[model samples]
Target: MNDKLRSKIIIIALAPIIFILNIITKSYPEFIEKYYSTGLDRPIRQGLSIITGVFPFSAAEFLIITLVIILVISFIVLFIKIVKGGFIKQLINILAFASSLYIIFMIFWGFNYNRISFDKIANLKIEKSSKEDLYKLCESLIARANTLRSKVYENPKGVMTIQGGYKDVFKREASGYEAASKIYPELGGKYGPPKRILLSEKMSYTGITGIYMPYTGEPNVNINVTDYMLPATAAHEMAHQRGFAREDEANYIAYVTCSMHPDNDFQYSGVMLAVIYSMNALADNDMESYKHLAKTYSEGVRRDLVYDSEYWQKYKGKTEKITNQVNNTYLKSNGQKDGVQSYGRMVDLLLAEYKKK
Candidate 1:
């Protein structure tokens, strides 16, 4: 009944209120589509991105680092408090913090989860694509990738390399989004350009190429990956920054934006990303055909894939598995029923678009 205890109870009460409102929003995707997605979220997302875009470094990354330090300090403090048998106050503080985060997330970007999917916005008719369709898509993408590999610069080892460093790549990436906005105007605005992660090597170990921080509306890219992957990864995160929440749709948008880009490097990167997804689906369907088509990759493309594979191979361990599980759970909690498998849905979008072409 003391002031502190009453405050804790009120904070805990807000959690169920937030949960019920979330359920109401989820039940009416149409309302969210018309009001939140097309109306409120767009302006909110744009305003945050524009404000944060002016900075050279990522505010989100800085916040993350600070949060980590705070967490570490909190654990140390909490341990000492428990040793002193002051557990009640510590528990209340932790609960209050957790509830506050849930509410803040709801206000900032979590409600966007209840909005109509990018599938509806893009009018994509996703279904179980036939094996033949997937195979053809892979073959076509491989050919396109091969053509693009020839135009780009290569390292001494014959692997494709970006002509300029990641800083230049970040500058050029906005052009793709500009082109994409023409096709789907929602993705077209002046958002914050992608920020390179200083801890990109650590990020790569978790299998994350890029991430969109909704808190700051910034797209943070993992530049440690190969040049061919960088452009698409940046574009993909930019897609999320623009309010395309679905992973597959973001990937498709990245492909569209990068392919529409005039630069051959961007074009190749877009095609290469799509090809990888398409080939992956084919591998699951028919390993023999997948191997046969994979064998058709040009020497340059082969070397590039191998290098990319080997780079990731070194990081395949407990941390990567744990991260994957966390990501899977996160996706599921956000209404992605397929969880981590939702990523494979990008292949469906790819097939739908390719069939149209």
Candidate 2:
């Protein structure tokens, strides 16, 4: 076969391959969770930290750098070819076509394969556990968190050194993870799990991002735990390590798991999140209770929440605002109502499940 004909055949074959992969990924949540996302992501993140050094450059940064280098090289080659005459234009055309194909494939794979759809996964379970069962599960987690909280708070200074700097909080969190592992060996593995956690040294708009499992094939999670967030953000990412992919499920699991754990820091982090969400729930009904709960939170948690909000607010630039508006429209196009904000609705399902129990 001619080279052109072979290229066409390859493109045709890729279409079906992409479709098959999409179907498999969408249909097998547990398989993916268990096989691809069941290890600690801290070490991968730590390596990324070292590789990127203190600069905190992201994948986006690397991509941008790569593109710039390619463009520069391409321009130089094309200019030389133009000066030489003949095949220069053809070469440039081939390069442009290849670059375009690469971009299209990236967009296709990103939207279809990279994105997580928890609602679809939840629906796939044949024997749906009752809400009461979920509640009981949550209760057990909460009980465990309470136990851990007492221990950490017993000698807070010993476990955590609060000297006011942001690095101090990172150190404290790292210590808490170490303590949790010592207290519960099953949760924190040796060597197999990530050793050092990576914080997006720069601020992020998202609450937290991390790989559910680093040893597994899953991607690393990168938490947007700026200096202002409550300790809960660390525990929340840890919940992802435990195999909760759904945002609300992660939030719920983080609260319950941390609450149940033997470490005081983990317990406090979990309860703090629960209190925040529960307060939001109560605000829809009892204003007085919401106010009381609001007051109950420590100044640190409140400040963190406020900081988290402000960070996102800054990113609402005109370009991002317009992009978000279009993105919401696109999300609604794909069976999600309330557009992108529907992620927060996971709380409704969690609350209902808790109440039924």
Candidate 3:
């Protein structure tokens, strides 16, 4: 009966309205592509990105930390109230807040899941490749990675290191998008630089290298990831900013942008991304061929890969398994039917582009 209760009911009511709109968007991809993705969403994304970009730290990261703390405090208070026999009121307050997040997510980023796919936007045909095709793709990536490895700076341990550390990496990553956007204008807009997470080391345990915060239009990267993979990972998150919502498509864009980059470090990281994917696909089909081609890796490239393996090995366990399960469900609900496996679909994009060249 109070104004607060009435407002919560009104906000919760919008959930169904938004759900209907979500269905409409999903049903009409062309409509969302024309009206939302390339139209209204551009300014929204760019504006939020510009505002957030001014800050040196990750606004989204800090916001998440704050929210988690608040949530814990809320549950504690709710429990104490329940012990005193107050429950329904607290429950309604939580539900109302949840409904608001759902609304915001749909307005800012959820509709993007319905936009025209990157393959169509880029005019590339994705087809299943033969084993030989996979083998050829892996071979080309390995060769490129080897050549670029010699060009980048490496630590005394022989592992790759960014020329200017993370600051330089963040400063320079946009250049890759600038170069690639010329060829594929769909990913053309400039937004904020990627923000390095203060909790990056902790995030590594969940196996997430980079993540895009759609609400703020910010690309967040885990600096704890190996340097050999960092630039490409940054580009991957940026692709989400350009409206490539699918993991596979974002990955393909990362490769395109990285290859177009002038710096050898960016190009090398990009090639390594492709190499790992193509080689994994090849191994899945023909382990003998994968083993044979991997032997051709340069000593520097091999050392970097080994370090990358070791860096991630320590993070594999129950935490990663649970995280992967949750991510799989999230991706599936958002139209990635293959779930986490959709990431490997980037190989199809690579093979398609390879055929064109």
Candidate 4:
């Protein structure tokens, strides 16, 4: 066989190898956690983050744009060659390329999905919390958020604003994890700061706050989001960068890390995120209670919340809907059975932490 054919065969063979590795990971979470997530993955993640962090822009964004261009060009080429033979060969080549990506993903970051659950790692008891527990959590968070909002810098409109903006936010993101790591060593580690997407306004249309690029170990934030939530969004993406792959767990980590951060803006942003989740949970359990609790938000806090809601209202359309569905499917495929609802599930972790306090 020719060298090209041999290479094609080798790439095709990777399919079964990926299958076996997936099974192994699924069946042995402890082994994967010890060896893969904590062991082999560290240098790979750190190395990618260090290399990509040098560039001021989002390397992942550039790579994604480049890949899209390549795909469009490839499709045009295939269409031009439609009258010719070898369609089967081209199809096989496409499949091989896809398999190669999956293999690369497994090597880099996908295996973290199978790592031991964050609850187990953090030694927190996540039991089914009651309405009372949820209400208390909301009450505490709302009061805390109100106080922090008063202290944080605000825009003329009274909306909570990051003082130094994205530049300062990115610089401060690591400090939260630094403080949190003292108590939860699992969260401790040096990683690259998140990069702001150049096309952040476009990213807002998809209703995504932030994204973690596993291939590059970069936390990417949509800078278009309201300022009140930006710090927490950065924390959330950084949680994924830390190898906590589950959405709910990452959300919980974000809150905890932000709570630990020194700056009032970061602290307020984190507490506000927890308050929103807790209030939503309370609303589901008791609307009257939620209404009463909502009234407790301080003037400045209420102002920021109102403006944040309005900001998102402008992006409500088909793009956001489709993105939610796609996001749900993606989460489910990664073992998050509750999918989008898993985000709300962070309230459970919040309540657990509250009870401890």
Candidate 5:
């Protein structure tokens, strides 16, 4: 075949291959869940972590290095091309290359969607458990937390010291992405650690939502007008630090751990939040109660939630819309039916697990 015809054929073939992969991924959700939840993903991440630990460059430093190398190489190539051909030819070539890169990026993003469906989680249904039973489970979790807290106070001075609290614990937990990448090299991507933890910020499409950068270890927990939600977000990030990649598992851990905490604020926030899910599971129509409880939050928390909603609304551009669509598609391909909303499905899992115990 001619080169043009060959290229067309290759592009045509790509779609079917991606489709097949998506089907396979969706077909075996359990397998993928097991692989991630078990320690299977750890070895690759751990090995890469050792190398990065030794090198020790911050995220910004690494970005600077990458940009410098790309610019230097691009300048050298352009200079050579200009000398050999002409300025017009080099400019045309650069534009063509840039266009091609954009196309490739879009195509790869589409494929990535096929590989990681979110809808499966959204579609999952759990057997309904009584509120009393769930509350009992919560009490058990609280007891467990008390036990853990006792352990923490065993070295109370050491655990609560400024060095340990702000420096060590925070630093270690924040290094979640680095640690995950070290253990699972395949999961490593261009973004390393996230640059910032944007709190109470609005997201683009959802108007109000939380986002965690699983690849970068950045936690942007955008909650709607609720100080009670902050501790859960913190606990969610802590779950990521402990290597729980699935959103639902992290949510479950966050709810349980925070509820168990000694601080009243944290416990109140955790229990109240869990009640939202418990109601969802049990009540036929509880949106009224949900709204009432949500309104009970302090004005400060409500302000944060509103600011967060507005923030995302302001940034809801074409880029974000495209990103959401692609992400939703990807989640569906991976076994999640409701796309990103599947993250909230953890409520069912948490209820089930609590009942089992």
Candidate 6:
């Protein structure tokens, strides 16, 4: 074979090797947990994040835009090639590119899927939470949320608001993570602060609050979301940046990080997130008790929850459903077999922590 063809064949061969390695790692979580999470992933993610953090704008966002443009142009070119009867050569090129991208993705951040779970690392007792435990968790979260909401700024209508706006929240987010690191030093270290997406409004329509771009090691947040959610969402993405791969773990990290924040707004937001998840679980299992607990929310908490509901209400559409499905598929492909439902698993961590305390 010619050198170019030989190179293409080698690239294609390497993809399966990486796939096999991924399977092996999944089967040996203990080894991946010990060696990859503790020994390798942290340092690599930290280094990438530091390098990317130097830029004021998001390198990940830029990369995404560029990739989309490249894909579009490549498809146009491929169409023209097919018309000219060069289909086989173009197909080979596409396969090689796919293989290279897969390898790069795994090396950078995808391997975290194979690392130890946060529950294991945190030593959380992640048993199925009982209805009573769920209600108690909701009650605790509600009380804390009520107290924190009072200390935070409010809109003229008496709903909680971030005093300075989303940009300010982004700047302040690191302090939350820093406070959290006191408890889990693994999440410590300087990394890129969360970036505000320029297309945040578009992101809101898709029902995505935040995303961690593993390629650039940047956490990007949708600033257009309700102020009550911005802090927790930012912390959640930051957890992913810190190498916690599971959506539920990221959510729990965000809750802990924001709850520990000195700012009441963040604390309120964090507790409110916990309340939402816990209450939803309760609603699923014990409708009467959930309704009773829901009615007990302080006026301030109720108003904020209503405002949050209305904010999301405006964005529900086919686009949101499609985006959610895509995200669900992506999560499942990465071993989150429950897919989007895996996010609800954050309640398990919350319940375990509350029970411990």
- In the range 1-357, model 6's lDDT, one tens digit per residue, is 799988998999999999999988898878876787766777788888889888988888889898888778777778999889887777778779789889888877778888877777777777766678888888888888778877888889988887789879988999988887887887888787888898889888899988898788899988888888889999999999987888888888989999889988888888988999888888888999999999889888999899889878989999999999999999888888532232257887888888988
* TM-score of candidate 3 on Cα atoms, chains taken together: 0.95
Once model 1 is optimally superposed onto the true structure by TM-score, how far is the C-alpha of residue 260 displaced, in angstroms? 1.3
* lDDT top scorer: 3
lDDT of 1 by residue, 1-357 (tens): 999789888987898899889878998988977787667787888899999989999899998888778768767778889889877787777778778778766766777778776666777666666788888889999999999889999989898898787988998999887877787877777677899888999887898888888778899998988888999999999888877777777888889999999899999999998988888888877999999999999999999999999878987888888999999898888787641232277888887777867
- Residues 147-246 of candidate 4: C-alpha lDDT, one tens digit per residue: 8877888778878787788898999889999999999887878788899999999988999888898889999999998887888999999988888888
Off by over 4 Å in 4: 339-344
Cα RMSD (Å) per model? 2.4, 8.6, 1.9, 1.9, 10.0, 2.0
Q: Which stretches of candidate 2 lie over 4 Å from their true place?
A: 1-12, 28-231, 235-244, 284-289, 292-357
Candidate 3: tens digits of C-alpha lDDT, residues 1-357: 999999999999999899888877788989999899888888888888999999999999988888788778778878988888778888778779879888987777778989987778878777766888888888888989999999999999999998678888899999998887787877888688899999999999999888888778899999998888889999999998877788888888898899999999999999998998889888888999989998999999999999998878999889889999999898888887532232266888888788878
TM-score of every candidate relative to the true structure: 0.92, 0.49, 0.95, 0.95, 0.45, 0.95
lDDT of 2 by residue, 1-357 (tens): 777755655655565565466456656645544443432233443443344434333343444456678777767777777778755454645455454554443222222222334434333221233334333433443454344434443223222212343344333544444554554342353222222234443323332234333223122334444332234565555544433334465565555445555545656666656655644545655566456545644444555456556656754456655656775675454334431232144444444435444
Give candidate 5 regions above 4 Å deviation: 1-22, 25-40, 47-125, 129-195, 198-228, 237-246, 260-269, 276-284, 287-327, 338-344, 353-357
RMSD of 3: 1.9
**Per-prediction tally of clashes:** 0, 20, 0, 0, 30, 0
User: So what's the TM-score on candidate 5?
Assistant: 0.45
| TM-score-better candidate, 2 vs 6 | 6
Which residue pairs collide in model 4, if any?
none
